[model samples]
Target: MRNMLKATTLERKFPLLAVENGCIISKDADITVAFRVELPELFTVTSAEYETIHSAWYKAVKVLPDYSIVHKQDFFIKENYQPDTERDELSFLSRSFERHFNERPFLNHYCYLFLTKATRERSRRQSDFSTLCRGRIVPQEIADKEAAAKFIEAVGQFERIMNDSGFVTLTRLAASEITGQDGKAGIIEKYFSLSQTDTTCLKDIGLYPEEMRVGDDILCLHTLSDVEDLPGKVGTDCRFEKLSTDRSDCRLSFAAPVGVLLSCNHVYNQFIFIDDHAENLKNFEQTARNMQSLSRYSRANQVNKEWIDEYLNEAHSKGLISVRCHCNVMAWSNDREELKRIRNDVGSQLALMECKPRHNTTDTPTLFWAGIPGNEADFPAEESFYTFLGQALCLFVEETNYKSSLSPFGIKMVDRVSGRPLHIDISDLPMKKGITTNRNKFILGPSGSGKSFFTNHMVRQYYEQGAHVLLVDTGNSYLGLSQLIHNRTHGEDGIYFTYTNENPIAFNPFYVEDGVFDIEKKESIKTLILTLWKRDDEAPKRSEEVALSNAVSAYIELIGKDRSVTPCFNTFYEFVRDDYRRQLEQKNVREKDFDIDNFLNVLEPYYRGGEYDYLLNSDKELDLLHKRFIVFELDNIKDHKILFPVTTIIIMEAFINKMRKLKGIRKLILIEEAWL
Candidate 1:
């Protein structure tokens, strides 16, 4: 059954020779060192920071030798989230959070950089020939070891330049990572197999006129090879509208549209070819003259010459390095129908970048062949256009997905883009790092803008993490959360208080736990009495103030001495009106200054038989220091002149008591609608 036609595998015509010490040596003697790059998290960088990152790249790329290729490849693979449900201390809400994103899919990214030194002949090669087009090519030997050593030193400097910037880091890939070993796939294998894992086996690559397919997965290539497809202006970063506001802005890298937004299995390939700077500028100058000579014959020539002149003027004026650049998004899917949809996604993503997407079917095989780890020297020269180094570096995707905080004390938050759960330590670690001096946060937003929603989520998790949380809110924002905790603890916590016509919020001003009346407690009782007795225009006289202070001290001693007597505002009111009134008369206090009858008349509404007797005669003890979660719902009485200030004073007393006693546990107090 032998046929006369010849058949060969990709391995026989493969351009790579061997991988040594994490460096790849190619058949054309190209030496490439690979590194795994770590960039800043997405949505965290500002516009000014983006420019700094671009400048860092400029300094890093300038150190490389002439004719070297800088290939930065970003891989975004669609991966389904697998929740970890085995943690022992997970609360009910935490467990539910795990289930909510059980099978959610997100685009996981991995970035790698390859710095290659190519031969002059290989750098000038065209798309007409490649290892896949011709027969086997013999590997060449490097005669000058000193030049290679110098390049390695320069690469070390390149790595130093990037790491010193504080925004990006580069880790050199190990030998085991560059070439597969011990059942683990390497970068080269992942590129050929189009898989994010080590389990995928090599597939057949079919190069047809209509499409390019690797195994059952069909490839979709979109390239920005021509300058006509580029926008008129470029910048370091662009504005993100989803999370931006008129008062504030959120910035992402300029190439972000084709980055995480594309949402598929794709590789963004960025190439920078470092040619001799002076020689390249001279060549452009000569081409500009040629265009000028043909301007009389065609108006198009005149416009082309002006453009070339502008490019030359900028390069000379700024001392810019002219380099060739090419970018492509190579996506693949096993389903042909899905491949068509991915093609459209890729095109639209490029359009978002203000670029025209060119589906290059004819050059698909060549571009794919050139993407292999050390084989970048075989890239077609015609596919790239010349631009300055600064302009080319702006197109890099300088962001990554969010990272979880390391501290144990934090709130559970969801990643906006991935829907994955994140533990953010906004309080503890921030204080340690000096990012914040204290954990006091002020949230401001218009109504219905999720301000209350986010605060509710934060306080709930904080309570679960053993924090004492007290909230004073005018709206019923924490009702559901409070109810959940209340039921979970079987009414042991999550205490909420609200005022209504049928039932009003009441407190015991004369009650103090542990049978201790300190100076602060005595002062609070005096303040309460003054507020009840004095009008807005009336100021208490000196004699009346001393009389009220004496009344509070006498009642505190009575409660301490007599255990059978229940301590409450009613008992204190009775003591001040009866027992203290006779003592005040025995001391012969002036009637006009003390005004006992007038005080009783003003406070009669809060006495035992008064209309508002329930306002201060509660027996609940209000031991808020022992309670871990408590909320005071003040919406019903926030506008009432009598109740709002009284309720606020009582709430502040409870919080101050808890803060003074519980020193070890974390505490949070959120005040909602506090304007009133």
Candidate 2:
């Protein structure tokens, strides 16, 4: 069979005839194109977004005219093994033992591929008179001008949908073509070609068994079945063994080989061969007749009649369609020893899925039949093959649920159980109707819960995404993050404002720039003054509030007129002290009724030379909005009864003002320990 197959492929390039800009050209002048559909890191999408994605995919497929074959292949690699040549002083013995016995370290890799239909038309016109006389329909270019235009347009629509959905994809930039060594191309000759190698096992087939020397990897294809007891869903308990010894107590009752084939091209292949309804009914009737004929003979044999009767009865009652499914477990390794280890791991993983793999090594020609066009004959029929036949709904219902849980875009963090890098998408969570909610998150845990580490991770991701993050924290929680961001941005972005008694980080709320006295700032200053003077449980009179507002408004108007001088807390203090008396008299509030001296006394501490003088009396040099990341370390004043509230309110106002000024940028304000 190998010799016969070798004679068929007379092309130098085997299956690939030529490389084109948009598609691959095959030896038969067929035009085939491949694309990759990248799903978002988080498969969890809002209902509306799910609808949009589904609609887009449906539209893409619908736009293609009849006779177009769309092959979607998802290659899931769950593990990667790297051989250790130097394990101990006994290098040869240790290395050999570890390679065969030890569980190799692995990485999880997954990718999707979409192969377009192959155009079977001949590019060039035939000029032979005899052939023309026979009225043969000469094949045109594989994809004609009209079909190609539609395919391109559909592809563009799908790409836009993916991008809008926060997903990404890639396509082949150049055309790929196949060249045949012979005029005729065989099934195996299309994808595989003879390469010189020293391995004697495959030498007769004109190929090398030593994959390391040949630069090609071996693909072991297996048909998986008897999965009735296995988990029906994709991500549910797919891993059989826990990589961590401490987590040995965690185990699944039933598992699937969904993420088991680590570091190998594992394809969960399911083929739906929809039989004609009338033909199906006729076959069922014929089976019934055969069952009646076999009843007389069944009495002599020990055949379980009840089981066969129940099977046929359920099939008819459920109206199930015929569906064939098998998992193709493939491992590709250049090193022969490593490949053997991968194969063993794959087999063990399959057992956990209740699947015993019957190796297809002898029938290597059909290994890639599932991916190729017009090769459906290569797959074994459901009747002859060892397969599980059930209601079509049972099998097809789980098909749409085969998406991986890992986010498509994220940092690779190790999965605790598998020890494989799990790509986690730390982007904003999805809200209703496909809209992403604000990136506001809360971390609530005990003292030793690693809250700081988790917060730092999120902060770093936010900084990387160009978000303005302000961390109002105590106890130096974000000191390391601040330093890292500061170094990364070259001190242009991150600012760490640590408040100390000696070198206090001053935030003057009353400090207004020259010629900038807006109503908002005036109101902010009035609120701050009110908060400072009004004692707890002692509501300020409407008259007292009116007096304060009038005083601040008058000072702002007075300051606006003088562009040469800047207004600080000292300027406001002096103005309020002198103007409040006149303002109270104007409002018919006698001096005996309201003690204006009390307000003045309360404000003295935050004035030029008072106890809390450093806070509100200094110039406004630090601009919190301009910095991408800012950490206000308030451990010193965090315990202070008066200073803490004063500073917290001031910082909150600063962030609010900064956010108001910036129109479109996303900003985060993290007030840690708000209860404090």
Candidate 3:
């Protein structure tokens, strides 16, 4: 990790000699020197461990004068070096380079080791730098106070961007803050100041309070590098030692600047100049205002989706991190409180991908649809979409349950952080189902709640329009309507009825099985099936009917091997008889002893389980049934032992079969009194 912070400057050699207490160390100075020093906690100003640090400063010298050594260490230099800005130039340097160069250590393995050494050095020099007083630099260390003040002012002119408000990610902003030209130059000058003793002793040059006028408040802090390692030892502690709102410890120094201490205290502080003009504060406020404005929208919409793209693209280009988008759809219940809960929970996690009301009409209750960004791991997973929608749905439901008087048909993008609504529509494209001429309507209610009445009403209305109608009645309740419609209009040719008691409808292998078959027939069946399944199989039908149909289909697929043969009640009954006989023969049980009802009970599971799979699995076979929505029509069958389950099995199998055949039929399926 430490190596990740290596300097980009190529080596431009400068000749120098190491001196300890004014004595030269080594005569041969050809090699690059490494300095190891302790660093304050990241984003803080102090290292927990380490009194003084050790550094081997490398300034290339042609010859060295023999000198007593205070501290010495070996280091390696790449044979060739030049002073150009390239990472490779300092890639091989150790902690010593960071200390000598006075730059942030590279974030990599090498830099880690360098930080460790630097912290150790800081521990050793705790006493020496601690005694230095504020407003006083090490004597004879600097030339002009005004130049330093001007430089500090220039540094303060650099602005820090507000990351939370816009499309920018925190990590990207951090990298920018570290490497931008202004940031880099400030670091260099700060290091230069730290290297001078006179500059280091200046009280204002050390860590200055944010507001000097405060009687007991450390509002801010600044650190000059001259106060950090002025004695030329990486281990020397030249940091601000005492901190209180009171300026009582003006003379004491610690291992790190007061800015770092404030940082550790969770108080925002930076090593910038004190400008009474408040220009920096104004800029900060302006940037914040800009963010607030950009983040708001008239509706809950994605914040500058285009801007997000640009930000993510730039971040990726810089080899930073990843970004993604998420979308979800959720239905609302009558209870409004549930809706609000969903909104509160999920609306905060994402930039609203989309906000669609649950209901689009005044009479209908509202619902919600959300689209937001998700982590890369979440993309393409059905559950991810469900999670987003489910949570949001809960909130929307809760809100409606608690507060229903609000206008219902509104769409907006939501800011995840502030929960503010962005009213603009971010997703400009409208969702489309498909193109078709069929009319579809939903008649939803609990059992015995006039669902059939609603459906019959629609059928009557449509039939009166002179349009052809095919009544696929899964429930016998429709038989009365069929007769009524047929008798009312000698438009008898315009209506057709299919039920268990009625004539068997021919199965069309493909919706176009008969070249002239009306397209509306296929479309109606598809729409019906879509609705039934959308309700999660609560459609009314005898479980036995479903079983019988599946058993027949299963036996045909297993034996005659012609799945194309649509199994009716008789075919299924015969297949079950044969299979029962075979099983009895194998067990040596007399067929006379077998009870038909008991045997059927034994066979139900297979039909329900594996047969269901087969029915759903055969798309080609289902294509034949697309035009005919196979309704079990259970009203005439009084013996539920033979009727209910059987009807269910038949409808289920037929649905699976037709579903296999059906592709984009815009289908709706109805099951009246569906629960068993």
Residue lDDT tens for model 1, 164-233: 9989999999988988787899898899888778954787777877888888888899998888888887
- lDDT per residue for candidate 2 within 1-676, as digits (tens), equals 4454322222322334444665555444444555545543222333344444444444444444333444444445434544445634322323453465345554333333333443322211121221212233232345367766675666566556545544345443332212223444422232232221112222112222322111365555554433442344432222234432554432221222434323354554433332233444565556656766787877632243454455456557875433234445545555668777767777776665555655556433333433443222223333122112332212211112123234433333444434543335545324332556654567788888988877876666656656788889878989987886678668776788777767887776756434465666667777778778886677888777777787888877877777554577788788777765676767787765567888889889988789887777666455565778988888888877777777777777777776777787768888777666
Model 3 CA lDDT for position 14: 10
Kindly indicate the candidate among 1 and 3 with the higher lDDT. Answer: 1
**Clash pairs (backbone) in predicted model 1:** none
Relative to the true structure, candidate 3 reaches a TM of 0.21
C-alpha TM-scores of all predictions: 0.87, 0.66, 0.21
Could you list the CA RMSD of all candidates, in the order they appear?
Answer: 3.6, 10.9, 29.4
The local lDDT score (0 to 100) that residue 508 gets in candidate 2 is: 67
Please provide, for model 3 over 544-648, each residue's C-alpha lDDT reduced to its tens digit, 9 standing for 90 to 100. Answer: 334333443355355345555444323444566777446546766543444446545544433435332222222233333533322335454434343344334
Candidate No. with top lDDT = 1
What is the TM-score ranking, best to worst?
Answer: 1, 2, 3
The models' CA-based lDDT, in order, is 0.87, 0.52, 0.28
The candidate 3 region of ten consecutive residues with least summed lDDT is 365-374
Candidate 1's displacement at residue 410, Å, is: 3.9
